[model samples]
Target: MMLRVFVTLKPSVLDPQGMTIQKTLAGLGYSQVEEVRQGKYFEIRWAGDLSAREERDKVETIVARVLSNPVIEGYRIEWPQEIPA
Candidate 1:
């Protein structure tokens, strides 16, 4: 199975890097660009034979425990041909 993880700061948290990128874009004539937020992306390819439900459980656990900080960051996972709950 192939999975994608996206980790980003929560809306309540401040992102100085995103702010800097936005400001730089504006200065570079990207006037239409309003805001920017930086994030982390991870791709995982698993060769396990687990079913979808099992795979989801394992992946969610990994994401929650290792991939993201729960306090100030949020994460989303993309499962192969499926919508995450």
Candidate 2:
């Protein structure tokens, strides 16, 4: 199964990189742009026979322990859905 994790800074935290990008965009004539919050996305592929709940638990553990910093960042996990042929 494939999973995706998105990590981002907490709302109260200041994002200098995002601000810089926003300013650059404005300078580039993208005046309508308001704010940009940068984040990280991870795509993980796990091959196993684990059940859905088990897989979700494993991914959650990985996200909490390895992927994100609990103090300043937040993360969300997305489970893959089957695609019809």
Candidate 3:
């Protein structure tokens, strides 16, 4: 199974990296750019007999507790396919 994790800063927080991208795009003629926020994206792949819901919950928990800084960051998890026995 493949797991995709997105770790992002909270909306209230500022993302310098994302801001840089936004400015660059604007410089490139993307004048419509209004805002930009950047965060970390991680991918983990595991093959196991665990259910998708169970695995997803696990991943979320890990992100909330360990991977992400709740003070300024939020996290999301994605699975490409359901677990099969």
Each prediction's RMSD over C-alphas, in Å, is 1.9, 3.4, 3.1
What is candidate 2's CA lDDT for residue 33?
88
lDDT per residue, candidate 1, 1-85, as tens digits?
Answer: 7778999999999999999999999999998989999999999997874356786788888998899999989999877764445
Report clash pairs, candidate 1: none
Model 2 lDDT tens row, 11-40: 999999999999999999999989999999
TM-score of each: 0.87, 0.87, 0.75
lDDT, candidate 3, equals 0.80
lDDT of 3 by residue, 1-85 (tens): 6777899998989788999999999999999999888788988776753475686567667879888999999887776665433
Ranking by lDDT: 1, 2, 3
> Model 1, which residues run further than 4 Å from truth?
50-52, 82-85
- Of candidate 1, the 10-residue stretch with the lowest lDDT total is 47-56
Assess candidate 1 and give its lDDT: 0.87
Local accuracy by lDDT, each model: 0.87, 0.84, 0.80
Better of 2 and 3 by lDDT: 2
Q: Which ranges in model 2 have alpha carbons more than 4 Å from their true place? A: 82-85
- Give the TM-score comparing model 1 with the true structure, all chains together: 0.87
**Residue 63 in candidate 1, Cα distance off native in Å:** 0.6
